[model samples]
Target: MNTESVDAFQARVAKHAALADPARLRIVDLLTLGDFSPTELQAELGMPSNLLSHHLRTLEGAGLATRHRSEADRRRSYIRLAAGALEGLAPGVEHGATRVLFVCTRNSARSQLAAALWQQVSEIPSTSAGTRPADRIAQGAIDVARRHGLGLADLPPRRLDQVAGVGDFVVTVCDNAHEELTILGGVHWSVPDPLRNNTEEAFEAAFTDISRRVNDLAPRVHAA
Candidate 1:
């Protein structure tokens, strides 16, 4: 190959190489829609901090991703896809139908709302589960969805393991879940749970917060 061809070939080879590992591929899948910090990635992927850090560094080195320290909290850094990485990875593919998984300590509230709103707004495939599954979906969650014209009648509280196989991205909707459960191989979002108050107003606020996060996530979910 000529010099230019050789470099082009090498770039493509590296991009594909970066995705060779299951964990790394999962990271790419998650970042295709948004950014995450190292700590967040560790919890979401359920890997050791050092291992997750190494993988993230590798991805960033390959120009597939970028990381920046949080302005509000310098100790934290967020990782996101490099500007053109998605287009290069899956040229011409439509991303509107991506699948996502929402998680919380209990599947009754925050995660449930996230999944329902995501499905309603993006028209994408989504599911909700808990690290410690709840016996039933929260009525507050149901009420919030109904207020937004989304239905939760058919949705059931599920365990993380049950939906693991179908997740393109896995987001933890509360700090407790984000800190406690070790997420394995999926995108992570750290959202606070609304069930703490157990009040109708609190549920409404939680629903609103989740809806906003879901909207921000829609582009990344649908980006090809």
Candidate 2:
């Protein structure tokens, strides 16, 4: 190969190298679908906050992901995959297959929205579950999805362990759940719980955050 080709090849190698860890891969998978806070990622992947933060920093440094603060709540920040990070990973490949799992304390709001939004935005296979499954999907989540032209009518809550089989990635959408669960197979993202408060304002804020994350993740999931 020419020097230019060799340089491109090595750069790609480094990108994949950064993602080589099973834990880091899981983190990419989670971010591919939505923006998550570091705290939420720690809970979902069941890793120490320090460890999760380290992995996130690595991903950011490698240009595999990006982080931004929520406009509604400055205290909270969300992370998503970097643009074009997944591109050229496979030449001439138009689509890649991926399976994503969204986790939260209750599979009612954030996780539910994530799963539905992934399905709507990309062709990748997706599912949502909770450490503690909710009785039903949160109404606010459903409403927000409807308004956004995404549908959530058929989705039902499920327990995390009930999702049998291998997933390319797993994401935690709640802080407590992210801290509580470990042994998830793939990338871990820490997204805050949207249903922690029942207020309309809180629900709208959660919806906006989820929507932005879903959009950011569509490219990676579809590329996979």
Candidate 3:
């Protein structure tokens, strides 16, 4: 094999090797659902922090996963599957729209993240509104979005009525809002609201969850 081919072969081998440990494999599986901080992973897996850290480090070195420091809290870190990472190892599901709308209770956090994330990947434009709009966007949410490189500054929060209407692809990002509105033919994702505690960790967790959902849903929205 040529030098380039040999390097590619070795990289694949390294990726495979990184998953050899059952703990690492479980970490990857959890991340597939949504990004989680090291603390969250420990709580979910009931594993030691040191052990989880070791596996996470190995996964990062193998180009299988990556971690991002929270803009809200420097001490906290979120681990997510790297783009194009483990592409061939995992089965791909083949899975779009226009003027997509994201909704939540306050239009403060979850919905905003979803709309911004969708904007990045989908050809369709997106907007966010809340069933009962808050006076302002949560500072923690703004920090998280900034970390993701989305400039959410000065974006005014809107009420659901302001943006809701037929022919709009409405997606509710809160369980309560989804259950209440029961938007006809609208998609719903039960995302946690970080504003409950108004903590940086809460916002970061919400951002990670919303980011994953938005990316996953982009294709379907664009195809519509």
Per-residue lDDT over 49-78 for candidate 3, one digit per residue giving the tens place of the 0 to 100 score: 888888989999999887766433567567
The global C-alpha lDDT for each of the candidates, from Candidate 1 onward, is 0.71, 0.70, 0.74
- Deviation of model 2 at 197, angstroms: 2.1
Q: Ten consecutive residues with minimal summed lDDT in candidate 1? A: 88-97
Error of 2 at 201 (Å): 2.2
Put down candidate 2 lDDT per residue, 1-224, tens digits, no spaces.
44668767877777788889989988876656545677767877999988888888888878888887644357867777776787744222223446777788778888878788778777777788888888998888887777778787475788877873463567676655655764563444455455656766777777776666666655654435
lDDT of 1 by residue, 135-179 (tens): 899887888788878887476678877776542566776655655
**Candidates' TM-scores?**
0.56, 0.57, 0.57
Q: Candidate 3, 106: how far from true, in Å?
A: 0.6
Clash count (model 3, backbone only): 7
TM-score-superior candidate, 1 or 2: 2
lDDT of 1 at 114: 81
Off by over 4 Å in 3: 1-96
- Pick by lDDT: 2 or 3, better one: 3
By TM-score rank, best first, the candidates go: 3, 2, 1
